[model samples]
Target: MTARPVIALDAMGGDSGPAAVIAGAELARERYPKLLFRFYGDETAIRAELARAPRVGAEAVVVHTATQVLGTDKPSQVIRRGRGTSMGLAIEAVKAGEAQALVSAGNTGALMSMAYLALRTMEGINRPALAALLPTLKNDSVVLDLGANVECDAENLIQFAVMGAAFARVVLGVERPRVALLNIGEEELKGTEELKEAAMLLRAVDLPMRFEGFVEGDKIGQGNVDVIVTDGFSGNIALKTAEGTGKLVTGLLAEAFKTSWLTRLGYLLSRGALRALRAHLDPNAHNGAVLLGLNGIVVKSHGGASVRGIANAIGVAHDLVVADVARKISDDLANFHAHRPAAVDLTSAK
Candidate 1:
């Protein structure tokens, strides 16, 4: 029999705290009985919620004790002075091999900092990238360097592509995914010096992936590239813009139908279409953000995530552990580095 995938979740990290976490956990337990969960938070609050609405057959939700670690706490303080904090404990659980993965809707900075400090980086990766998954018209594409490392070098960008490619292959179940460097235009001469240089390096390297050349921002959701690579500064701005635009459109549609009777009638006529649109716009569908290049799997969910959002994030983390994504990523990169020339010395980049 296969061993259950164990995950350590920071229940106190999100805006919805123990209640949202509890609901999400219950949903996941019912949806996926094979998953084993360990929640870290205040024992009293969790037990109180449990008393009010107990989840039957919740043996998977083990309680890990921690005093407190708010979303506003500093990463330095959380890592050093604070020992029993929820985020701290979750990272340590992965480090100690007690958990296959760690999921948190806490401070993104703290999660990344703690994961880096705890599990460290894999070989050939100087700084790990936070790959926010975007559901495109076709397959999902990863936008990496999502505010993790603002300043990345040519070598860093190239290595990010390798990592992103491996990630898509395992988590996405693509045999050989298409990898592309995100630039201003599809032409190789369009992006900044770093992007152009990185594209050249990637062109020369013998990656396990198929290089789809350069891709622009407009090509993100066009199903042209499976993985979109860029620096944190650029990637973060693009991601926020896409998210903001999606929200604006959704809000506008809702207001348009609510204002007048004719519009309401039209909306009623297209209620099924609107429901499909709303389901597509739900952030829970794209809730998973993997902090790639770490020794273990660590997924970060949106801090403002709802119950369904947290549950979906848990589901993503469960897949990563079960697929041995961490090991596969490290091995794939290791092979690519051995074949590539001595350019950046990625063997020491970790």
Candidate 2:
């Protein structure tokens, strides 16, 4: 019999508290019937919520009490006082090998800091980066450094590209995923020195991925590349801009449909297409953001995620654990470094 993979959840994290957390776990339990869950939070509150969720079987869940970590808690403050906090305990579970992965809808900075401290960076990795799936016109693309390291060097960008490619292969099942560096223009001479240097290194490497050269901001949503690599500063800004645009378009569509009876009739007639559009554009559908290059799996759900969104975040963690993503990334890194030419080291570039 196969051992059921365990997931540690921060039950007291997030805006909706334990109730939504438990409800989301129920959704995950239904999707993965053999999964085991470790709930870390106020034991009494967790139990109360779980009791109301008959679908989240008691046999499948273990509850552990924690002092709770507030969303506003600074990363440094939390680290200094986070021993028994829900987020800390969940991460500890993963570090202790009691759980294969940990999921939290808490402060992003706090989660990243604690995960980095507890799990550390994987072997051969300098820093852990935040990576997530973004909906695109052609297909879903993976983007990295969503909000981790605001400033990065050539080596950092190269690492991000490799991690993003691996993520795309595992998550999107893309064979030899096309990797592209986000740049101001598609020209080789365009953009910052770090980007140009990173591109040069990628071009010289004989890795398992294809370096598709440079991709502009507008081409990101066009799905021209399977992976878009950029520094955290640029990646986060692009992500927020895309999210806002999606919302604006959605709002405009709703207003248009409500503006006239004919449009309402048209909406009714195009309900199927509209539903598909909504699903494709919904951020909740892509709720989980992963911290790659860590020794243990860590998934961050949106602080204000809905039940469906939380469930999806749990799903991402589960898949990463099952896929042995950390191991794959380590293996890929090892292969690349072993075969890379001696002249390609750009680690010290500013």
Candidate 3:
């Protein structure tokens, strides 16, 4: 923990290629002088970007990688091949203690696969969830399992809540973030037995978090919950829907302003407000989608992210290391699980 934080970035993993990734790395260093990076990708491509970037201390951000992880390849197959692939090699850097964490804008499946294989999960976490930050009226919300796992039961959901709490506390500075399960209704007995049982499970547990009961879908963008937990199926839908809605609104706003002189003039008047709204809703501000429950921090950025997106993600990795989130998670889980009930009957409803 005393060593300087070095982030392992898969330069070739995002859709933009190694150029954007390298630029992001430079931006990160410029923003944080103490920031160091280990870029993993094709040597030629990485070196080219470094040449064009602002002068950074040589050897501070080294290209310690070989091949690249492609979007087309299967995660399982790629993990097996172990082709000096960017994602694979990046994880290796962390596994070998050369880096504090790994960040990728490439394939989500590949990142999770390689991360689980290399770092494994924390002691008490049964499965890790991909937690993304979505903009809302209350600022940002942590939505988990954006499609990391297809199926999860009550216990798994509870675990995600705990991990999400620890993360929000560390990163967002929320001492006790409110946890919510996505449901059709807010009533305790609203959904299936799984929902009700999970609610009970969450309340029964002694987590270092605040469980505020279940949240509805409409509450997602309204900031009703700090941590929105759900099965992968539903969580993925909410994530994609919110993204689509944001784009749709922004596109419509642009079109409306271009149509007429009156609207255009009005738009000019409102441009400042629009920009502020855009910035608040901008996904880049929440660039880092953390793969929680992993032993090491793994930040997953949008595959088609711009240089700015990657840069923000690097800043996220830096923040995570500074907060010592992983160690805190390990410590919290050790205590929580130790006092958990042996077993709770969660039988299916008739």
Best by TM-score: 2
- The TM-score between candidate 3 and the true structure equals 0.93
**Residue 323 lDDT, candidate 3, scale 0-100:** 88
Return the TM-score for candidate 2, rounded to 2 decimals. 0.94
Ranking by lDDT: 2, 3, 1
Q: Pick the candidate with the highest lDDT.
A: 2
Off by over 4 Å in 1: 50-66, 258-260, 342-350
Q: Model 1 TM-score?
A: 0.90
Clashing pairs in 3: none
Clashing pairs in 2: none
Write model 2 residue lDDT over 128-247, tens digit each, in one string.
899999999999999989989999998889888888888888888987899999999998868888898889888887776888999999999999789999999999999999999999
* Alpha-carbon deviation at 53 in model 2, angstroms: 3.4
User: What RMSD does model 2 have?
Assistant: 2.7
Model 3 lDDT tens row, 211-271? 9988999888998678899988899999999999999999999998899999999998998
Model 1: per-residue lDDT, tens digit, 18-98? 888777877776677777777788877776666554442245454667665777788887777555788788888889988
List the lowest-lDDT window of 10 residues for candidate 1.
341-350
